[model samples]
Target: MSEKKFTKIDCKELKLGMRFSAPVFFDDGENMFLGEEKAVKNYHINAIQRWKIDYLLTYGHLVTDGKTAAPDSIYMLEDLEEVEEA
Candidate 1:
């Protein structure tokens, strides 16, 4: 497994088909996600549903999957940063 840290919201490092696990705060409280995008809008809804995610504050790109579909966005948390350590 590889990880990359991002100091910016929705760091461009996120890509399609790549899995993300972020712990966030929601109106109901807090939750986490370990999912990948299946389409353009899936990530938006997925993030909002899992936590109080606002796409405007986040920005992520598609991960290159040489053989399958790509994802949309990658939500960012306060103290979290992606690390690329394989």
Candidate 2:
């Protein structure tokens, strides 16, 4: 069996089809999701932004192919900063 892994990531990294390993919560500790491996949606992304949630816990694997894989290693903000400095 493939071992499951989780990671905390900036909400900005969230994309449609990414699955959550745990229920996302408000910074105030309110439960925001109660489903297993919930797939991300646009409204969910909007809510994250509207609520100003900076980070969330999600499955480390980007694809759900029943195999272990590393989370996306690229950081969008860091890349943006590098571009700005150029």
Best by lDDT: 2
Deviation in Å, model 2, residue 54 alpha carbon: 0.6
* Predicted structure 1, TM vs. truth: 0.24
Alpha carbon deviation, residue 22, candidate 1 (Å): 9.8
Query: Residue-wise lDDT of candidate 2 within 1-86, one digit each (tens)?
Result: 99445456677887766665566544444455424455666677888888788876544344465543223333346567899999
| Predictions in order: lDDT | 0.36, 0.59
Error of 1 at 49 (Å): 6.7
State the displacement of the C-alpha of residue 10, model 2, in Å, after optimal TM-score superposition: 1.1
How do the predictions measure up, each by TM-score? 0.24, 0.49
Candidate 1 positional error at 32, Å: 3.3
Q: Quick one: best TM-score, which candidate? A: 2
Candidate 1: list runs displaced more than 4 Å: 1-4, 7-31, 35-52, 55-62, 70-86
